[model samples]
Target: MMTNILIVDDDIHILNLLTIHLSKDGYQVFQAKDGVEALDLLQEKSCQLAVVDVMMPYLDGFELTKKIREQYNIPVILLTAKNQIEDKEQGYAAGTDDYLVKPFEPKELSFRIKALLRRYDSRADDSVVRIGHTTIDKKSYEVQTGSRTILLPLKEFELLYFLMSNPLQVFSRDRLIEQVWGFDFSGDERTVDVHIKRIRERFSTLTDDFQIKTVRGVGYSLEAKRS
Candidate 1:
């Protein structure tokens, strides 16, 4: 099945550019001039992902992202000119799955779009792995520890899964970013740190059997501390 993508931007040129690139990559592309139109199209038919612009007339990208998150479990990439830390933070807070600054290479955008969509891809078998008492089900994005189960946000879950899958193999921040967020992702190392912190906080109370260890001056590794 051809993946459907929605491109929302007031600029016709941007919409055309994204449409051309995404369509060439075999995605069924749809375009909207603003958030309202995007929402309307979403109601009519669902899209696998959305590439949205920040500066739209009636509704901006941030608000549109929030609205999309309210009902859809789809990935959203905010394509915008704002590249400040605060702007990125705001985009994440608004529920955007990825952020791409303006003047971005279409190839880079394609990489990010494909990376985000991969999270939603379904597999033939349940991808489950167990480390001590902690059980991770990649298919469901749930981590089961003892009698309790916790659901993780996408990035944290991906990071945890990657580390657990390669237990004891230390991975640098750059490597983690490249493998998890895709090679063309423009975000820096801080992104890895933030997701690692969240994952550690979530799993800290669940079990001590496995620990995500920071290899000072190196990177991080998941070690099973059998008691």
Candidate 2:
């Protein structure tokens, strides 16, 4: 199946540029001028991935991303000129999958989109894994804390889902490095910390043991469900 992608940006040039390039790669492209419109379209129709801009009119990308986390596990890439570490943090905190600093190449954007879509596809499964109050339905790309839902971005949700599926299993950061981010990733274990912190923060209100635990000298593990 041809993958669907939604590009939400206020800049006509960026939108047009990305759409043109993505379509050539055989993605079913959808466009939105701002966050609100992007969301209305999302409610109406779904996409496999979304590319959002930071400085939109009515709703900013950050706000839109937080809202998107509420319902969808679709990958989102933030397109913006803001390159500061703080700005990237805000985007990641809001649950953006990837960040593209402005003045980027259309080819680069195409590559990033492809990477995200492939990552999403590799983790596809319907098996549901539960740990405490949290339940992850992999097939549906759904995350739940009992009945209350905690909105998570694509990477964070996938990270949590994998760990939960293999509870109480000690995985070295290197092993997690291999599975969660894939062997193609050359980054250090620090990337693991970032995603783990995000998961724990979201489930902080749900349960104490819903936490992803740090094993002191070892790596990490999700607490298993109590039957």
Best by lDDT: 1
Instruction: In model 1, state the lDDT of residue 124.
Output: 21
Consecutive 10-residue window with the lowest summed lDDT within model 1: 117-126
Q: Model 1 segments beyond 4 Å from truth?
A: 122-129, 136-207, 211-227
Local distance difference test, candidate 1: 0.86
Which regions of candidate 2 fall more than 4 Å away from where they truly are? 126-161, 164-227
Q: Compute the lDDT of residue 123 as modeled in candidate 1.
A: 28
lDDT by residue (1-227, candidate 2, tens digit) is 77888899988887788888888999888899999899999988869999999999999999998788667878889988878999998987777889999888889888888898877776555387766666788767788776776657877877887787667787778767655676468789999989888777777777764557899878998776456
Query: What TM-score should be assigned to candidate 1?
Result: 0.62
List model 1 lDDT by residue over 1-227, tens digit each: 88999999999998898899888999999999999999999999879899999889899999998888777878999988877999897887676879999999999999998887876664223398788888889878998999998888888888998888778898888778865886468989989988988888877877897888999997999999866
lDDT (Cα atoms) of all candidates against the true structure: 0.86, 0.81
